[model samples]
Target: MAQVLGGITTSHIPAIGMAMDRHEEDTPYWKPFFDGYPPVRAWLEAQQPDIAVVFYNDHGLEFFLDKKPTFAIGTAPQYHNADEGWGIKPIPPVTGETELSWHLVNQLIDDEFDMTVCQELRVDHGLTVPLSLMWPGNRYQHIKVIPVCINCERHPMPSPKRCYKLGQSIGRGIRSFAGDQKVVVFGTGGLSHQLDGERAGFINKAFDQYCMDTLVGHPEELTRLTNDDLVEKAGAQGVELNMWLAMRGVLSEHVTELHRHYHIPVSNTAAGVLVLENED
Candidate 1:
């Protein structure tokens, strides 16, 4: 049977993608941020999972105010990157595992999670940036992907509890697939930093650290926080952390955090990264 090897969580700040695209890693402004990923790259090289189920939000690139699905799954054979109004990030297209994606879709619906199925989708920096950070130098070409897009851009988004439960459903779906594929799930976004309004540039390092520490063992405690609370404390965009809960739910109840990297003010965001493995 297919096995979920583990899950990874990280911030998907667009500026990080730009820094990489422009070859600015050594610059003083970006060096600290860039320094956090070598270990992640090394870890991924060793794990070498065959598939990555990416959970990220769209920032008006594919879905706009006209229509937005709270939960969408990409079933396409391949997904291309979007411009996001600033031109597309130069990266190889993401190949998809269509059969597994369809199976997951059916399983999720059977589990009472309504998801928007997309046969064609364009990924934005929120998805591509993390992929780049994890599998740099086009190593992403070696593995297939299943894009799981969650709606965190608008109000009435999925609640923290709902997101966690959705992740549980995804974990069940992956484990039930009849194959020997090695899979890794990703929850991309957050670590508390706001972008916009008078409170813009707001960040709560304490709350971010608490989340990183607690999510490995007691994700249930995080569900107690409301969206308002996340926005107020972590910043507006920080609410995207809800996506990480889904990634966490896909793992074994007990997980060993193999790697963690956190850095401040990565383009007005508290960038965080973690690699977790299901305890054998």
Candidate 2:
């Protein structure tokens, strides 16, 4: 059976990707944010996980408003990164863990969760930025990827509890897989920041801190918030915290927070990164 090493969460702002493309990590504006990843990268180097299950929301790259599934999983053998108008260069193709992905699809469906299974999918910054942040350059090619996308753009989005349950289902599936690969789950996007509307550039540091602290030991508390409550407090786009909840769901009931980084006003977003290890 596969071993779930742990999970990671990072903000997936396209501007972060653009900064890396422009080699601005050390610049005054970007240095503090970029400085947060070295310890995480070192940890990855020490524990080279064989597979990564990424939880990210689509930003009109692969799915659009016209046809967006609440939950989607990639079962393709390889996922390609394309130009998504973020002006950032697309990274190399990511190999997929097909067999395990199929296993997860079966498990999720069997667990009474409706899922959209994609045999071919094109990824955007939502998926790629975190990879580049963690692995740097082409080093991410070392592990196979499995993408789990949640719909953050449309109404009727999955509730935080629902997404967390999805992660639980995925965790069960990974443990039951007939292989011994080490897996790392990624929940991308959000601390808090509204992209548009009357309260554009809105951010709630208090809520963001509450979430980060609560997520370490009491994730269920976050699930208690309705989508409206989340939007009202976290800002519209800040609701992407669903992805973080999903990542936490995949871990053991007990976990240790290995590292965390939080910085505000990164492209008008409250960027965050967390490293959690499953406690036996």
Candidate 3:
């Protein structure tokens, strides 16, 4: 069986990647921002796991509201980093671990988790931004990926409890996977920030800090809160926390915080990063 190497939690702010491309990791405006996670960069290199199961919401890039899927898994042989106005980064397509992906897809259905499987899909910043941060500079060269797209941008979204349960199903899926390899799971989203008409600049530092530490220590209570509570306190856009539950779900109550960071600026968003792996 494959052992899970660790988990990564981070925000998917599109601007972060843009900053990196401009070589502004040291610019006063962006230097300290990316530098906040020296430990994260080192941990990623050291672990060098074989596969990463990434959980991120699609920004209507691949799936639109017309046919949004609550949960979709990328089983494609290769996935392209799409160019949504900005030119595509042109990274080599990420090869899918089809063996394990198919295995888990069937099992997730058997377990009663509604999942949509796709053989070909283009992933936008929702998946790529966090990836560029976690595995910068050809990180994809070493690790293959399984993309888990959540429907956060759309209304009538999945419930917090359901997202938590989905994580449970994923943990069970990984445990039941009959393969001998190492893997890392990542849940990417926000701590607290909104992007609506007038509420765009909202930030909830208290809740952001609370959710950061609580994700590894007290996920049950974190999952209990509703979208309204997250919207009102965490800002409406911050409901992206639903994506984080996927990471929290698979983790045991005992896990160490390897690295974390939080910030808010552009488009009225709370940008953050949290990475955790099993202690064992």
lDDT of 3 by residue, 217-259 (tens): 8888887888778888888778789888887787666788777
Residues 1-280, candidate 1: write the lDDT tens digits: 8998888888888888877778899999888888888877777778878999999999888998788999999999999985677765657798887989999999999999999999999888888888888876656877899999998899988998889999999888988999989999899999898778999999999999999999999999998888998998899998898889989988999999988888898878998888899863
lDDT, candidate 3, equals: 0.78
Cα error of candidate 1 at position 221, Å: 0.6
User: Which ranges in model 3 have alpha carbons more than 4 Å from their true place?
Assistant: 86-92
What overall lDDT goes with each candidate model?
A: 0.88, 0.91, 0.78
Clashing pairs for predicted structure model 2, backbone only: none
How do the residues 159-249 of candidate 2 rate in per-residue lDDT, one tens digit apiece?
Answer: 9999999999999999999998999999999989898898998999999999999999999999999888889999999889999999999
The lDDT, on a scale of 0 to 1, for candidate 2 is 0.91
Question: How many backbone clashes can be found in candidate 2?
Answer: 0
Once model 3 is optimally superposed onto the true structure by TM-score, how far is the C-alpha of residue 69 displaced, in angstroms? 0.6
Ranked candidates, highest TM-score first: 2, 1, 3
